[model samples]
Target: MTSASGFLHSLPMRQLRGVGPALAEKLAKLGINTVEDLLFLLPRQYEDRSQITPFGALIPGMTTLAEGEVKLADIALGRRRALLVRLRDHTGGLTLRFYHFRQSQKESYRPGLRVRVFGEVRLGPLGPEMVHPEVEFLSEETASPESGLTATLTPIYPLVDGLTQRRLRELMARALPLLDQTDALVDVLPARSSGGWTLADALRYVHAPPLDSDRRRLLAGEHPAQQRLAFEELVAHQLSLLQRRQRQRQWPAPACTDSAQLSEQFLHQLPFQLTHGQQTVLHEIRHDLQQPTPMLRLVQGDVGSGKTVVAALAACPVLAAGYQVAIMAPTEILAEQHRQRFQSWFEPLGIPVGWLAGKVTGKARQTQLNSIASGECRLVTGTHALFQDSVQFARLGLVIIDEQHRFGVEQRLALTRRGLASGFAPHQLIMTATPIPRTLAMSAYGDLDTSVIQGLPPGRQPIQTVVLPATRRDDLITRIAHHVASGQQVYWVCTLIEDNEQIQAQAAEVAADLLRESLPHLAIGLIHGQLKAADKAAIMAAFASGQIAVLVATTVIEVGVDVPNASLMVIENPERLGLSQLHQLRGRVGRGSAASFCVLLYQTPLSGLGRERLQILRDSQDGFVIAEKDLSLRGPGEVLGTRQTGDISFRMADLLRDQHLLEPARVLAEHLMRDNARLEQALLQRWVAEKDHYATV
Candidate 1:
């Protein structure tokens, strides 16, 4: 039962005791292989049938177990190809109907046969029926009352095509013993603070709860054991991020002498005054740029918090110091948007700016590339196309990445390395509109100098977020018509289009179609991810120019599209979106003097999480607050979509729950590195090796 050093390195499908070739293939499809993976393959849900009641006591739609005698076995052709079997207990009669049951099952359903059925029980014409109930035979030796019923919470593991719940349970049972043995070995957090529970205790408690309340508590993520495990995962993540930050800190940056003067000029040139938050963050950025070490800073602000302006101010010092600056965005549209904004800001100051992206082609792209290479383009902005082999910068000093989460670790490193190639690494600024929870920021962006813009501009209007049920579509459309009539631009976001152009597009089209009929005179433009590059750009241009009064779009406009005239954002099916997304959508409005409004339209009977998402939007416009709530509700994984990429790499830690673990882990990492750099390096190497081996197996 002990964990061997190379145990996780072995192919899991091959080592699983009862897994045959066919079952192994199925396990592979579920990404379950090796002992480690199987151990960590936590159940998606747990069904509690431990308190099994009698058939008569069971309510319709309530999952309960029923033991009965097969009074009759009738093979009658049912509507739409179904087979019906009627069974009766001493107190009640129930029918078992199967749509695809074969003739072979008939022999087992003899009149005298005793069977145990586990599924939902519904009232039928004669009495009650269980449709496609999981069945098992009853024997004298195994006829304990609990035998007919699930005596404990049944752990429902994630499944694959050919894998069954039974098979997954069996495999999990076998793997549990092995996992338990290594529970002591896997200790990453201190035992005292972990509520006196070991990892083994947590796993056992999660899988086999002794009571119904315990099952509920464990699944709800309130159990101490679960918290311990989550902490361990967070500790590992924090340690990794801290290490990355430390490594980046070692990189040298050329100190810019003109930083203060440039920053002053950038601020002076702005049309509006900077918010206190913006000024504080810009000061932090200025301080970082003044340091000899390259600045690996993350500027996180809510949508429309004027983050780009802060970034512009940071870039000014590098540009003024005769060093070229480059900004990379996640999408072409965002890139174009940044390009235009930078042009507007810099062109007035006579600072040359260049644009490059996937769509930028032929002579224009070539000319931009030449400008960048010759240092004629002091400020270059584009998508990942900026990292293409042909693109080069004469003296790149500052690299700003917008929506940093969209790009991977390698991509960020590639841009940073470009600056280092010439022996002069640039100051790095990573920006995101998605407000990361504080704990997550510590774990995910620990290496970066973090700056948060918590306030909006002085004259910025707060977007009023309102939640409306889908039944009030007519009222909402009328409101939109009224807004359109006033010449204020509106962004109607859809969750899906007719052809799946984007999930948002479908919702946008429905709203657009309805709005078109209501306000036929207003110019309406449809834009989505599936549209051609030129078309999207054209649509965006028309909207920005006020030619299009209403623009129907997907989440594509969530990041950098700026139209001060657009005062309203109607997000249809807002329940389908995350809190961060909803916040971003709302940010599209309230950028100008016009009083902006955000209508969050959702279908009735919303889920608990859905309601929480909408409520979070309605309650606050602060991205940080929304982000914390998002982490609490959805966990860090879903909140940030952190996968294998270094952006979001926590394996088990819930940021909302384990915020305390981050600083300790970060400090420990630094202390470890300081005491023995080689030891720290070796540990990181081991972790990476283990991760690679885990991926391969």
Candidate 2:
């Protein structure tokens, strides 16, 4: 084994030459703490200084290489002191300016010395000048003395505060040769794999490719070397998801085999019949519940797709078998909404409905806790408080999570564990109103089986969406007054609650006041994030009961605030929100039989992307289609909410462009885990370094 491959992977950056505390600190900012990390820091671009051009023919904005002899070197003073060197070739003369220099540095640029310079040229007070250019002094023993230039492909790396491209390229040059002497570093991929390359070779090519390599492909992230690295990263991620699912399934779950009695009773009592999509998904959930292993299923449906009914019906099996069921929501309002719905449906059947939340306190809270612990709270609904350590279940059997994307993976896993009673894990059913595209679901939720509700229930009305400029403010106000006077409710959504000054979004308070002045006969209410939970609940309740004609609120009412009577929605600066958010807001109305409409009021001079987003919303009411378009337009992070939302995130692989690699990588991951433990471990160690907990496969 050679020095580079033998120990370089574990070598600290501080051990490298010229990497003192200061330089190492600067490098650390770029996440380069080890020799291996430094090796992986490929050049962001390259400079073609291979051909030397005449000093007189150099273009001002073009970077070129030139050889010249130093005529005079001295210190010049203006607003600041500087060392200036005058160099001349046969065609023209150029000046080299250095703002900070020592006397010894000036000595190196003495007269009668041949030097090579590479940099962008600019017209200064003197002739074309190259400010602080890279200078290489030529000596008698220098290999390129005739040209006085290093005629090679120059790799330019990204640098930090105290680092320079030249210094980094030199470090790469020193490290590259060491790998040629060692055979310890091995390729993780099998030789049979197509487009495979040795790990060491890939590193060398990416850091310092030949001048003839494909630059276009490199810039577009289509280079063979880059594809190989991306594919490897995707496989590691897929393996992590597969292994997590496997680990979770190893625990036993209580089998609700005799849920027919409970399901029939619950289904017969529904006010309306279930949609075909809902029935199909419910069947899938019931199938998973009877299995010995824990059920990890995701139920995705658009807003108003009857997901709440499906969730309640799915729990009847677990509830009837003398075990507890827990339902978790993302927000207090959503949780309370679920509580009311469940209480209305279940209390008639003599079953108890337990409600708990951050706001639920005193004797009521203790009573709910006791009911949960004493096996009396057969079914429970609440926010994150349901998973708190103080809350326990006597024989927890099933766990249902609503708006699951809004919760973190740790939170979900903790709730899953809360259902573990007597070595039996609970059946887990996670629901999300934000429809996920097929490619995204395959990559992000590969570990769980997915069932999607593709259609809304009967009697649902398609929302009429329109894009209007804010100039129609007066017209919109008149329209709103007419709708409210006709016994219809309105949701006037404001993106901000207070004046941001930086943003032009209409604040909730300002919008409410404007509406009140325009239509003084209508009762308007305001709600935003800054308002207390009790206040928000009260305002939402009032708006739902039709006491408030116009409900001016922020995104707080984006989800789980159901008011079937609200048929008009006026969104101010709708372009400020994402497509999914805009879709969710549109869904708030159009729930009732009355003709519904959504007015997207936008500020003028919209951006291209913003226009595209609004246009997409205006064209489609299908959440799935809108979601796919949103993913393409906004990328995954914003579409998935945030890093705190516990959705899947990839650092190197992109779901939009690299989605083609997901299914194949997922297949390969399953094979590796089942047949090749050594290779799987190697891949996890190489790519999924810090995410080892999820890579236990």
Candidate 3:
């Protein structure tokens, strides 16, 4: 492999001309694998140490450098494992305390020895004291650099376990000069014809600022280098999405001429008219289905926006073409709900429907698989089990994934590959009930054609959201009982599954026992994550069918469980949940034409971030608008759940704060791929090599 000149291909810290193995291990812990990595490791913070003050002028609780002689050295144990040492200069004396120290190391200090201590000093009963101060030995012949100094500032960096600020400074000094010798790479950014410093100069100036004024100028957006780096990251990301989209569009799809006819038939049989948003999105889906090439589209809609109906419409074309369609949901409960709803809708049209899940067993599982393989099943719905080796479709034409955010790129690719293995690649339609912010949608889903269902179904009432402190538990239960007495169903969502169950069971048992004393007619059922699938299903069924008046549950009911009769949702300790989660929980209500109410009971003394989260929800009902606010309030990493995989990984460019970087980055990415293929290939190879090294480590 070719190596860039002046840039060390590898730098052993021990062989870096000055460092040793002990220091090398310390540097390695901080990811300083080579001279290049060390060069790029920026300082976390800077402290000005150029000004040194006299002992008389030193203030307690301020970091200052003091040069003094060790006037007295003795091991005097205090209350705990404490050792005290006294140091004095011509002006004053300061006591240095060590809480836990080895006797041998303490004995190394000698009286009259001069040293420079850099750390914070605090006022003690005696005068001023410094505990375990950072001390550096000095020579008697050499006057202390910190002696009688007025002012000084030093740069501090994030240190690893054994690394020190001094070691890091030395490493940077060795590497920074090498960066100057390396010729600036071909500038991918357009020149600032409007009159400013070039990108190369900006980078150089930022790296080695001439003065404190220059450092501030570089950091204050006056330098073009920061902008250039941000733009490069954005463009690289946008280009990747565009390329993937282009590749997807090239796949051939089975011709489905009967899509419109089948879609019309399905719509005519619906119980209610479609919302305008639903209609608009359905029109978009029909256009994609009628196209000669495969369709890769994303249907983004808020909770309870009738997205399932739009998905049902998209599947019509495949069923009408005599090809099978498969829709995958994230969980078994959601899969069952889709299967039941779709089965009822398609049963009238003589289209066979089948369901596959982890629960399917014996002849039932075999029957479903056989029907799907033989082309007898027109629409198949399931969870991740649909991708199992045992599951096969005769002529899968359309693939619709519900809750697309929960599935990674590899899972989506696996699903697409399954459809293609049968001959023709199926048209892909991804649906997300979690409304993505506009900026996020553009960056995250730029590759797919997007359709937004912005409105809810007609006759659905808006849920009344109310925030209540958890201290008013008794009053809240009284209100809940009144709702139950009126024949309305109530859902009490708990935060945890097991621990919450125990807490809820105690709360419920206490509440039920109290209610039994007054009114013994109401039935209270408890459901949590620990329950068996069948038991959970039974509990949910009882609540939906009105067999139980009030059901206490975990957040499992946040997704696809629909009950029109349930009108009350009481979330205990709402602050414990995220903004998105609370929004989803509230969505469980207001599904019916009846007026619904959601009470968010939060704990006292809420954290600043937590209070802001709940306040945003109380102020708005629009999920997309709330999502944008959430992104702004919390960073992209928290909003996207850092644990999420695939293309979501980003190092420094945040989708929220750095939104300005996106469009320009996208344009540059396309230009590089189209106009500069060699550079694009080199970047891709470098990215993969770095990823591999990271994974190995």
Candidate 4:
């Protein structure tokens, strides 16, 4: 019970006896550069060799230990040549085949030799057999099957080709004793934090559970030792965020103040009234902007909840304070959409809206860059190009990131660094249509004050969602024609751009062609990722202006494309997508007073999970609810996106699985940062070290 002492010191793997440069390099390949890292590298599974299973008791698909005397050893010539050895115990005989083996290994497997083997049992050519089983020779004194059985469980680690399981175990054997002798590996957690187990005891127990250990519990990562370690890792992750969050607030940011004269004027100039949800979010952002410290707030709103309107409104205070506002979008389409919306709202008010994107090049790009830097353009909206080194902002104030998940931490930090170049960190506000559940938001980050923009805009009709089989798709065409006759447009969304050889879903172009044939009178348009950005924009523009009666497109239309006249949406093969995404696609409709409909045209014989996902979408209009369900179906990493969770690669903790630990981790992180100044830094260093990912400016 002394495998890992603690995080008091990060002893380099090279420092371990017998670990030379080559060995250390091999260890590094598996990310085990330090003794602490090696200890943290818990086995994915363990082999129970305490009691050898008899050949008769061996079941197919069971990984177990067995011992017998080799009765026959010869090369089996067939479609695939293999060295097959038959071993017979007192109960029965089992076959062990090796497709890849040395001649020496073949010679060693002589008939009448007593041997022990460990591997998974699977039905093979000669009944139940093990492929390339681990074999051990039993000498005359240890010929009994029970004599060679290991007293404790054998740990199986994730390893490279050169680093065998036995070698890794030997390394652990050497490291565990050091834990008891050295004072370096100190337990970072408080006495009460790690249940009743110290860090070293937990590590030791995890790495080498006794013969009586609950094998199932340890493999499932349900053991108390495992949970304690998961909790500690999660707390360390929170501590990292807490450190970054504190460092971020230390820098001064321009306080745009309550000079909402322009914001109010902009709101008054709008034809439509802001919903209560929009107002609430706007109020939160306004309050954040007025603070001296940089505002790192994440605003969550469902599609059609009017987040862009809120973003535009948030930017007004920065403009009124004579500071620039830069809005970053994920794609050119989204960025252009923001630019057009911002221009319409601000250009009339004499504030120039600058645009920068990957396509904007050479002199024209420089001209716009100059305008931004000269402070002539008070508002700028673009994709990642906005954070490029060449794109300098003149007194930048508020930096609003749209669809926050699309951008990673590096981009966030790049923009933060950009703001610092202007003498003060910019008040940052990020918006995402994927409304995060309260639990997810808290677990994902201890930073980023969240503002939930709930409810649709005043005139938005809750889209009536329906689930229908693909067999009824033809009937949908007629219904679409009738809907078009009534002056409403339709959107037919495809999951793919072109016909895929494997998947049966219709492609965007193929669906558009078929729709044109089905409704010869209706104008059909196609849009997808493969199309040029300008062409996609033009097609979207046509659809928006009602020139295209039916827009057959891929999932690229999931966000930033809003057309109030387009009411009916048919998502083809809706089962292939996540529920949250289906909600976003449906958000493209229901933007206006017209009663909207979303038809989930699914393939026949839907799987249970696919059916569940579709039904969840059909029932719930709340993005948060759908997101929570999505989070349940797909873990936190998939729901939150890898970009955001890249730095939060938990060694053991799963946000969804160990959600109970999130609040405790958050609370402990706060306490550690407040009370124990010295140990807090050490704890952070042990778990977080050089990996400093900033989520806030």
When sorted by TM-score, best at the front, the candidate numbers are: 4, 2, 3, 1
| Tens-place lDDT digits, model 3, residues 645-695 | 246554334577668667666666777878887666544432222232111
Worst 10 residues of 4 by lDDT: 497-506
Measured with C-alpha atoms, the lDDT of residue 248 in candidate 4 is 89
Best by lDDT: 4
In order, candidate lDDTs are 0.75, 0.81, 0.72, 0.83
Cα RMSDs, all models: 5.3, 5.0, 5.0, 3.1
**Structural similarity to truth (TM-score) of each candidate:** 0.78, 0.83, 0.81, 0.93
Cα TM-score of candidate 3 = 0.81
- Highest TM-score among the candidates is held by which one? 4
Over 23-72, each residue of candidate 2 has an lDDT whose tens digit, in order, gives 88888898787776777676656677767778889778888877789999
Ranking by lDDT: 4, 2, 1, 3
Can you write out model 1's per-residue Cα lDDT over 1-697, one digit (the tens) per residue?
Answer: 4232324435456776888788777776756656655666665467766654566776788877677788877676655676677677667777888877778887678887778878887887667788888887888876677663555678777666667787777787777776544332344335686778876677776666665546565666667766766655554455566655656667677787663776776678777888899989988988888888888788888887888888888888888888889989988898888888888888878887788888889999888889888888889888889878787778889999888878766677677767776677788888899998877777666666788888777767888989999898889878988887887989988874243555555556776787788788888898888788788888899999999988988888888888999999888887877788788778888888999999988989998878877887899988888888887877777677654243554335556656776776666566755675544543343232233212110
What are the per-residue Cα lDDT tens digits for candidate 4 across 1-697?
Answer: 2223344255778888889998899998887888877877887678888888888898999998889999988988899999999999898889999999888888998888999989999987667799998887899988864685667788888889788887898898888766676565656677687788877888888888888988788787778898888888778788877777888898899988856678778978999898889988888888888889999899888887888889888888888888988899997878888888888889888887889998888999989989988888888899889878997777888889998888877888888887788789998888899888777787564578888887777787988999999999889999999999999999999884234522322466678878888899989998777677788789888988999999888877888887889999999988877778888899998887789999999998999998889889988998888999999997778788888777677667777878888888888888978897766766665566444445344
State the lDDT at 463 in candidate 2. 92
